[model samples]
Target: MQLWRRFTHRLRSRQAGDALLALPLGLIVVIVLADVLAARLPLGPSLLIVAPALTASFASTLVTGAIAAVAVAGMLIIGLDSHLLGTVDYGSQFFALLVVSGVVTVFCYLRERRARELALVRMVSEATQRAVLRPLPRQIGPLRVASMYLAAQEQSLMGGDLYAAIRTPTGTRLIIGDVMGKGLTAISDAALLLGAFRESAHRQADLPELAAYLDRSVCWNLAEPSEVETAGECFITAALLDIPDALPLIHMVSCGHPPPLLLRARQVSALRATKPAPPLGLGELTAAVYHVDTFAFEPEELLLLHTDGVIEARDARGAFYPLAERASSWTLHSPSALIRHLRTDLLAHVGGHLTDDAAVIAVQHTFRQTPTVVHTTDDSA
Candidate 1:
């Protein structure tokens, strides 16, 4: 059953491509009709070569060869009718037409093979991205959440920045971070952090504990496999937040990362950390000390957590993007709407290019809905 379905799907996809088949067939028909109508012309079916040339563009190698065969047969008929089939002139024309058609058919086959290989590579890349950075759920407990990732690498869908939301008995736990460097090295570190957070976030009792656990885990990964020496500056800057379902306050911990932005009543403010800690993976010398800072998350307020790639984006004048100022005007919008506006504005500011990987997570606090009570009566009575 699966094989049949796959075959049907491919057939449906090819229906739109029937025009490619029609082009060659239509040209061949015209050549034959023109030969009959314009027999008096000195040229002997010279236009028939067009059929195979057009076929090479959209047809397979086999189809191109078949079209070439038809053209050769037509040439032979025209030669015999013109009393030129046994002459040197006929042999030369036939050889030229055969060489051109054969070359086109081989070239088209090679081009199509390269295109298929690229499509396969792209599929593998997409699968890796999905596993490394899973998509965030739009609705988590009592919060309306939205997230986006913008990669700086060309032809790449993911990079060193990361974010994740894990719901637990306590609250909706959130993380947003950026790892130094780019390409494969940064992406590997980002994936390691995301995996550790998801595994330990719910088990840890407090925000500080969760942060410390992640920091220690990253430190362990950065340490030399066979020795106690650790890699220098191989750290990840991160911010963690916990928003309980029943309160209008948020608990946060920052580790050498930019502070989260709070948008309330058309006002924007940075929720700075009281006692900052060093970035993860540097606990030995720095002895990372995390502190949970409480912030007001009023109703209709939107909290924006983003990587530095956003604020550091530069315009033609080399000025950084004013995220807080511009985001204040979007306080009245929902989480998804605010993200959409920011994405478009950021691209426009940087002239449609980003220099680093960027990630954004917007959490909105809205009015709680009253539970609906359904009352039933005995209709039979």
Candidate 2:
């Protein structure tokens, strides 16, 4: 009895005027109308069970069970009025509906339990996301920053992609990275990387040094002494950037990561790295040395940093998402607007579902009143 009240309350509060309920209610009304208009069709009463079967999908288990009982009662009434309640045909019909209602009621109960469990999982995932992925501030010194994250798997709310911006003694530094894999394992790796960057960003003087420190951190944590570190798993593709408070120049170090796109004067251009280093964990493979590439970061310009999810996102036709081309026209937009447009457009491109975890960060250079920079710039070897 207590369970019944909870079920009915949930039903009443949710979709009170639902069109789906109309299916069952309209079926009841149609049966009554038909009984008056025609000689009783033998199979007419059997159709009543269909209502409860459909209700299991949208209504609570208890509500569905109640409707199933009502349907059985309606069938019995029709059988009695037709004077065939005890007949073999009536008995068969009655037994069949009884079995259907019982099966459907059990199914509905299990389905509701699973849905409740999934809700709990989603709540936990949300909390994990908030802790691991710290929200990027809109304004960081003279730059406007915005970030967006999309999980590939429906069950997981956060995944491997990560980005962070920190104000240090040297300047404003940012890191955009993608840890291999997806779901919890990948996110855990991403969180570790972000934590290391935050702790070391201030200590390191330049992008190359910061990237090297992060590479060492990742290699140490991921590769156990007993295990031999390989290339595929436990790797991170990342980009480190230094945008000083006063300089119009930006320094970058690409670690097997995609280069950032520069949006200037309603146009988009890729900042290709002349000498890129190996991904984070595999720093020992190559020179493991990231060349600090310097580029002019003028006011009113926007730099878009993203994981591979953006370019690799394929549509129904297997056409990859042209992020640079699409974003070229949105150069004039604010950081928030730029990210919003990319979020909506990317989802639409992939038919609202991504096959892999994705993240995009947009940083817009704002106008400053200061005429000259009192700081000295560092040169990379």
Candidate 3:
């Protein structure tokens, strides 16, 4: 039954395209009849060239060539019937139509070839992004979560922004960060930091220790000889959070990253770190010391973690997006609903385009009895 439906759908689509393709031929027939019946008028075989030129825009090279052939044949028939086949005027028209159709066919082939190459490149980039930036589960431990990533580069799937969540014996630990620059270098740095976090998040005893381990990893990884060129200025701003299942307290360490916002009972406030340290990869230069900042994270409250790209997005007038102001209205929304609203509103504020890549994760504290499985929903649109 499914096969029958699929076959019928394809048949209908092909029939529609076939009907659309006949338009150029219908045009050729009309022009030929006009030239034959009203020989005195300026209407002649000159207008037949329009058929093939029009077909090239929407049809394949084969269909375009076939239409061009039909058009040329129509011109010959008109010229022979009118006794003008051998005249210089009719000959020039024939040659012009032939040359124009050939050029259009060549262009069609080149365009399709480039399009196929572009599609292949896009597929590869998307696959690499999935492997590096795996989506966060909807439910982990005692929290409901939602995540989204928006790339600034057109047709790009990955960027400098990164995030990950790992379950520990005591609670859940999550990391969100952004590399310094854009392009391939930023993506490479982000992947490196995420990998280091996922590997050490479980082994590290505390938030400060985990943060220090990540800092050392970034610093050492970027200092290699091969990366010396960008290593001088390479750094990543990150925020790490430890949420305990039984406690209402949240432990965090900020590394020159934007502070996450807390939404509770129709109020929104930024959870700024009191003793924030320098961004990762610069710990050696700055002699940075990580500190744990505890905050009250009771059940039924939502926490919003995002890259700077979100707050930095500008409108036509160059005004930055007011994330906290806009989020105040959705304080009662669930994690998923909050993310959906934020994504829509953010895009609208930037006029459907962003100058920098953005990554967002919304977490709601909840107490569920049953064990939770990974349910990830990513908005790459």
> Who wins the lDDT comparison?
3
**TM-score on alpha carbons, each prediction:** 0.83, 0.79, 0.88
Per residue, candidate 1 scores C-alpha lDDT tens digits across 1-381 of: 999999999998788568678877777767666665687245546677788898887778888888899888877777766677787867787888899888988888898899899999999999989888999888888899999899999988889999999999967999999998899989988999999999999899999899889988887888757425537668899999999887788999999899999998899999999998888887667877889999989778899999999999999999999999999999999999999999999999999999998899999866464578999999999
Report the alpha-carbon TM-score of model 2 versus the true structure.
0.79
State the lDDT of candidate 2 residue by residue for 1-381, as single tens digits. Answer: 999999999787676737677887678557744753577875687787787888877877887887788878778778767887889987888898899989999998898889899889888878878877888899998889999989898766678899888997646899999988877678878999999999999888777788889998888776766545543358899999998887787899998899899999878889989999988988865657679999998988999999999999999999999999999889999989999999999999999999998989999877464766699777873
Between candidates 2 and 3, name the one with more favorable lDDT: 3
Predict model 2's lDDT versus the native: 0.85
RMSD of 1: 6.7
Stretches of candidate 1 above 4 Å error?
1-51, 58-63, 224-230, 367-381
lDDT of 3 by residue, 179-291 (tens): 99999889989999989998999999998888889989998887798877766488899999999998787899999999999999889999999999999999988889998
lDDT of each: 0.87, 0.85, 0.91
Candidate achieving higher lDDT, 1 or 2? 1
- Cα error, residue 150 of model 3, in Å, equals 1.8
